[model samples]
Target: MIQKQLYFNNNMRQLIKSCKLGRDWKKNRNFHSYKAVQEDAKILVQPMHDSETRELSFKKNSNVLIQDGLLRFHSKDIKNNF
Candidate 1:
């Protein structure tokens, strides 16, 4: 449980900071097939709705705050930004 929260917290912090800087995050890129994609910076992350706290990475550069497992976002469409 601690590890889970730690991962969540760490990712959350990254997300918030990225939002402030105007970055977009990506998750599950299957980089094995595309080596070039690995060079991209990570920007945002969230637990995919279908998973049990597994992260679905995102790419958005802006300030986002997550409190008590809830997120406050500034972007409209994160996928487009990535």
Candidate 2:
């Protein structure tokens, strides 16, 4: 009876250790997955930010060009009149 009790205790300890190890492995796996998702999100957002900046830059350059053209045109008209 004591031998049987010792065997039961040993099995229970093994089971508890396995359970704890499984939980730790699962937690580590989940943490890596979360980090991968965060990296992917950053990669996805970076291109959108770059495109938005480029679009804004293009618009500003276009406005500057248009204003320059208008100024030149007015200046030519004034020189011709004088």
Candidate 3:
């Protein structure tokens, strides 16, 4: 898949930074391992929501934050965005 330029929050930015700092934090390729969020000039991620289901991906540029293994995407009309 192709990845585009994106941003994230401070919390996520720190997470990515720490992951690179050592082997304590590992990266997930499928995007279901962790939650994701998007902000301006934050970090690289892919959390865009599904156009039909509105269910968001936990990918790097995703916006779904995991709250106890739950995927949450706040979108009224996800199709419009897609």
Instruction: Give one digit per residue, the lDDT tens place, for model 3 in 1-82.
Output: 2122233432231111111111122334545442233222122223333122221123333343333323233442112232
Best by lDDT: 1
Looking at candidate 3, the ten consecutive residues that score lowest on lDDT are: 13-22
Q: What's the CA error at residue 68 for candidate 2, in Å?
A: 45
Query: Distance from true position, residue 49, model 2, in Å?
Result: 8.6
lDDT of 1 by residue, 1-82 (tens): 2122223423432221112111333323443111113223233334323222222233433334444444433343123332
Is candidate 1 or 3 superior in lDDT?
Answer: 1
lDDT tens digits by residue: candidate 2, 1-82: 1111112322210011000011111122323221111211111111111222111111111111112111111121111111
TM-score of each: 0.28, 0.11, 0.20
The regions of model 1 sitting more than 4 angstroms off are 1-49, 52-61, 77-82
Which 10 consecutive residues of model 1 have the lowest summed lDDT?
13-22
How many residue pairs clash in all the candidates, one count each?
15, 0, 9
The Cα local distance difference test for each model comes to: 0.30, 0.15, 0.27
RMSD of each: 12.5, 35.7, 13.4
Please give the distance, in angstroms, between residue 10's alpha carbon in candidate 2 and its true position after superposition.
Answer: 48
Q: For candidate 2, which ten residues in a row score worst on lDDT?
A: 13-22
